[model samples]
Target: MLKSMRENVKSLKWVLWLVVAAFVVSIFFIWGASGKLTGDDAGNTLAVIGRKKISGDDYLQALRNRIEAIKSQYQEIDRAFIEQLNLPQQVLEQLVEQTLLVEQARAMRLRASDEELRDRITSIPGLQQNGKFVGYEMYKRVLQYNHINLSEFEHSLRQDIVLDKMIRLLTAGLAVTPDEVWSDYQKASDSAGIDLLILETSKVSLDEAPSAAEVQAFFEARKGAYLIPEKREGLAVFLKAEDLKKEIELSEKDIENYYQANLSRFTNPESVRVGRIWLPFEGKDKALVEAEGRRVLERLGAGGDFAALARELSKDAKASGGGDYGFYDWQSLPQPERDEIHRLTSGQTSDLIAEADGLAVIRVTEKTAATTTPLAGASAQIRSILLDEKARQLADTRIAKIEKEAKSARSLETALRKAGLKGESTGLLKNGEAWSDNDPSGAVGTALFGLKEKEVSAPVYTYTGVGLVELRKVEAPRPAAFEEVKADVETALVNERKMETSRARLAALGRRLEEKNWEDIAARNGFEFKTVEAHKRDQYIAIVGESKTADDLAFTLPLNEASAPFDFETGTAVLRVRDRKTVTREEFENVKETQTAQILNQKKNMFLQAYLAKLKQEKGIQIKYDKFLQLTQDVLSRYESAKQ
Candidate 1:
């Protein structure tokens, strides 16, 4: 019975299956080995959770899998973005959380049966076709495509199922009460009308500038802020692959070899230019919606203009634009939709297709048959590829030879001169600054800063090519003279004075609330009065800026009452609530189920977070951040090398 049910259930979509594969493979890479320390003198442990130590090989492989996953999403992934996300620390933290949960699951004696694991694998949509499992060979092919081992994938799947079962046990019976549901409904449905007055700092003027003594004092107090940054002077010899492309020559054999190796790249998939007319149900009876869809299709079949009919009767957002969905590859659409579309010839319309939310009619305006480029037709592209390959090889050889000579010579400049290459001087650069205007990659600067005076660096790869750098000089930061920054100090003091004046005026306006009309006060104080109508908590109030402080105050203040001055980026706002509305009982009842589900989910998430935190605290989970970072650097080095 379980196998039959699993076979009937739809498998996970391909994209989701790939994500699961990546995550599962990463876990195996972290803990798949014999659970023993190996190789490293400092021990191969990357982290320890409870009684288990996560090995370096596991962590490195996990990191590599993560990089590959990221690369799939982003075409131009870089080190800076990776560092910004602090991915290594994030991955380690996730592993630690998983370990805590798995340990707790084991303590509770929770386990997943082999049948359950098999059922789960068979249920994935990516491994199924035509409502049936695609057999073991196909399943293995899917795993191979995702770079996952069959045994390891099954092991991770078993662990995931166990963890899920444990989580379900922990969160079972969680519910939302009537009061909680009512409170959530009110918050979601409430809206406020507000009157606002804004004060702009730019409009406020100061009477006097700061004296020389005051300016000097300000500079003295913040002298470190004005210090000159340290600078470096260096010479770099660069070799670019593209520059060497003109020197290298490609033959017919090379072109044919490239073409034969990458035939898939030269093949074009079949595509259809498609247009759609969507009729949304919009709470209508399903039978009525289907009838309306059929009526539209009949009209289209009987010489009705698709665009005109769509503009007149279609409820889709793109109705006015003729409901044109444009060109699409066959594989890009859902299987059902693709099957329907494929049966139609160009300029033919399909019947009313019942979809999840509504009904759709598809029209194929044009079709392009799939074709593969012949060797003669693909010669130009292949030649370009071979040329690039040859250029890179030659450039790499040249850079290696240059690096060897630079290492043996007294100076990089001497080596470059001997090799008939001219080295460019960067003149001066700050520690964190680029070595040259053209060196935006910062590889040269990074290499130069790490070197001592007169020291040369190994070849560093940049966007342009490879670079060899020599450190010529280093100048440490020093405090600047007061006179040099006197103007800057004056400007700062003036802005501070203006801000004080603006605040005083705003406060005085706040104090006169009861006696004066807000509109009259705005006229008297040179502030503009604006009204915001029926805005919810999350909605942006244009008059009061995008800040939520005004929104919160509007809801909290009594109707027909003014709020204290709220400060935002543009300036300060004084707000008054004009009206407020709460959700009606009938309205709340209509969405009670949805609200309950949302609240229950929120409670579950909170409980899970707190559970993880408590488990970490109880287990005394200790992380060596330095070790994680070093491991990350080593993994990134390997990733970069693999890419090259």
Candidate 2:
């Protein structure tokens, strides 16, 4: 799931990149988080050191526009690179960090006015053709086409400027010293040597056990390494628009009123009444399922119950319900389903229907006459519709109130009563079917997962439109108490015992071999003793790369020497190191470029982490990391809900 999320993040980034690239691409879905354009769109802001809202919409669009620019520059651009260029996370992080830095600059009384923002944007080397700032008309046109206005556009461009300034200062002192680089280079080329005397601990296990003192000491030494988790106390309230609709009481009078006022929404559509028959095929011969559909179709054509035939032969979800799908119009069934139905009349059943999953059988149950529904006729439905609308409005208002109430309540019981709702509590639960999709009580186990002792949840909408809910409390996560984890702990102990037994046996073998040699030990142990050739680091069977085993162990052996058997966690193995050698200069140079690039990247990343840490400290840049993460979560949650 985490891997998929990473991929999704990558995909989001690319989406921005693609939009930035082609002027021809009209993007609305991304700006709406995979939906049509919406109101909860994001915003952007630039500050000299104060809080300002940034537009999510502007940020997403600029991200898309950046891709367009890249594509225009490189005609052969691919989807992968565009995705890397458009990380929403990177954009958000950049937005927050830049906001912080700019705020710092502002706190010190820094000011970049309208003129500076414009000059900065236009002065971009990529944007300018002739030295002078690009024409505002051209800039305005691009921004307009990308679904943004002047101010939002300026906000993003200014953020880029603040980032450039802050980064330059923070990273100003970093350099790759010649001495350090040379030392790294020499180490990369060097080989380490070491020797070992194997003592196989696994060869013994009497659970003749550790003395009580030893066991107690082992547990005590590791006591502080374990811990409990932090729990939260919070309040939340959700106003589901759907739930609000349920309480809406629409009277006949109200329906009539609504129909009179909004007459268009109630008008009936041109519709077809239909039924079906299904058939299956097996090679060139008659297939069982299709044969059934054929038999039913034949019976229908020769005067039979269409619904009965459908019930017997149609392979559809509606088959058991006598294939009765209520009235449908042009917009009701998609074009394909509608077309098939449109081909039939009230008494007609469709021909042997051939579909990949199975053959289909269709018969028109009844044809709906084309007519305009009068307001009077649609009054009841209109009332229900209007009632739902009213209910939703009420639900929203009450939900907001309830959420506010929860925030200050001393307990869930108090909050629920005040909200005019009910609450239920449950013991700790693992995320599972009963606590997830199939949760019986529903409220306590569904929706956002992390929970603590007295936190409320955002409103969760029940599919039945019963109501929205909030989880009021949860217990903190902790190491399982002794009894709770007894089974697992026992399994671990048993495995340890088995390993000890094996290690002791190996230790005895090693001792005998050191005193007598491999032949006598192998003869008595009923195993073969063999030597492997001196192999390259990359050719090892057990360890990978230039690890301590490959580095220290492999290079230390004298030519043609037999080492004692070693105990690995899973088993015991003995090695006879035949030779030790270094990589020739020619061989090392062959892969030098790739190796150097990896080394540089590793170093750069380490430096960046330290640099950012220093900046946070030396500049006294204090952050409520938890609160900040909360803000990010708040924005994300709001964003997800708006799309829904």
Candidate 3:
């Protein structure tokens, strides 16, 4: 259909014009279209790429689309994971790069054809049903479900295609040399054998413990390192929601209201318990795989037990357990597999279904229909949820009232009594220190550090409950008296002496390597002389720990030449190369293609990085770091609010 449409230039021109008209009409509804953002609207701008402003709303929508894509692959995602990704920063950079590419493409008079855009949209599998395009309705529904506007998605798609074309045009001529390929193959396949002497810190022992006077002198000389941590002492008045629950009373009307509002949460999707017999391709003849699949199906059809056949013939990891794949909803499986499963009833088996690498035979052992819990059934859960909400609200209100009264109160005790709560004093605590197990969330600790002596803190939510805090005293970090930390100082001094002694002994042993055999010296010192045979680069040596230095020394040093003591986290190592091997012609030939591909990929990545750097410099990219950070914080705050 798209080919025919592309062939007719007149129709294509009309379609392009219609798309342009629709884009122009939709600009009013879009959050920050060019020339439309001003005043309060202009504040929403996240970044500016030349004349184009990427708005906060646009960035957030893009982020949501990305999150939805990830959620499809992973069931449970959390705020910490999202924050770790630095998604807001990444999204902003992507938008800037995209805008740069689009500008360059337009400068080169490049445009995506109407037919090309149409083909791209229809080609997306999500917009198809029963192996055919489900038309515009299904496309609209997909966009709606993902919180994307149709116009915005189409615009983004066109931009992506244009940018991809630009990238291909720029990177078309990259190639790898034969010499580079051979070097990569040699690096990957070459192995080395070595004899190693291992000396560990734990092996070093002191003859005697340091005296109390010596320990005191050592601490006195390094008093700065022994200064006490700064601490704060304060009083906390807690307002627990569980305590507030005693005062909260829910009515039948409230329970019914909650049930009606959150009915979706009470509904369960249809699911299936399935067993599969898989015959993986494994470079075997495709005919053999298909025949095996058919044979399994025939056995099942002839009343042969599915589990017994699966255990005997299937290649899947679950084959050992009768190929039981456990429970799955429609969305849990790939569309092709899901469609095949949907065609089977409980106790019925599927025909051979071809996959990317294998053929699978599925038996729907059991099926469960979708269900919605009745009002009575859901009432108990709804009541619990409502009660928790009310309790939190009541706690917040009480804490707020307590905070107001505490500002003028002479003591936290008076304030607590007024608020109908108990107050406890937290003995001197370092910043970030918890008081017993009371403030496991560290809310009190965080509050206390920011408060001046005798100052009351505003209400802050904590893991245990809501609370108002008052800082009673501030303790500055100071050097401890000699007697106060004598035991710690003794321990430190002893360890330092042991390390010095070990270094002296290792240095003597390293010098003697030229005079005596390494094995004889190791035996004299009761150390193990271990040999690692035929290990490649990037492989770890067991006795020397996972030291790359030891591996490199083995490869670099000549035969029988011992290295100087190489100090690592664990201890020191003396490595001597025993033997070295080079890649043979036959070995190189076997891995030639794979090694060439790896080298080419590495070169391509480097080239792409350099090209992008040049483009960014040419475009005179500028970013306001403060504004970016502020926007990121705002986004995270909104996400946290939504989760709550």
The better candidate by TM-score, 1 or 3, is 1
Q: Write the per-residue lDDT of candidate 2 for residues 74-169, one digit (tens) a residue.
A: 424443454456444454444444445555555545445678776775664434434564456545544554455556445545544554555555
Task: State the lDDT of candidate 3 residue by residue for 1-644, as single tens digits.
Answer: 44432233222222322333344223212322331222236667766666666666666655654554454445445556677887766666766665666678888777777888898877664444456775675456545543456776677566656766777777678888888888777667788888777777678878887877788789989887877878898988777667788898888988888778767666755667888888899999999888888778778988999999989998977899998876632234334566788888898888887765688888899887878878898887677566666777677677767777777775677878876778888888878777666567676888799888888876656544677779988878888877777778887787777667766676787467774467788889966678878878777677566677876786788887888777766666777887898778887888788888888778877987787678787767655433454445434532331221
Q: What's the C-alpha lDDT at position 610 in model 1?
A: 97
Query: Candidate 3: deviation at residue 195, Å?
Result: 8.3
Q: What is the TM-score of each candidate against the true structure?
A: 0.54, 0.40, 0.53
Candidate order, lDDT descending: 1, 3, 2
Model 1, span 1-644: residue lDDT tens: 34633332222234335445555444454444322223243467766777866667666666666665575455345666676777776777766776788789899999989899889878865555567766666677556754667776777777778888998999997878999989877877898887887786777877766788887887888888886667788888877767888898777887888778777656765667777787878899999989988789788878999988888887766678787655522233334556787888898888887664577787888877778879998887667556655665576677778778887885887788888999998777765566554467576877778898888876665545567788998878778777767787777767767667766777786567664368888898898777878878777767455777886787888987777776776567778788898779998888989999999999999999999999988887655433464566545532321121
Candidate 2 structure, TM-score to reference: 0.40
- In the predicted model 1, the residue pairs found to clash are 11-123, 11-124, 11-125, 12-125, 29-58, 30-58
Global lDDT scores for all candidate models: 0.71, 0.48, 0.69
lDDT of 2: 0.48
Q: Residue 451's C-alpha lDDT in candidate 1?
A: 95
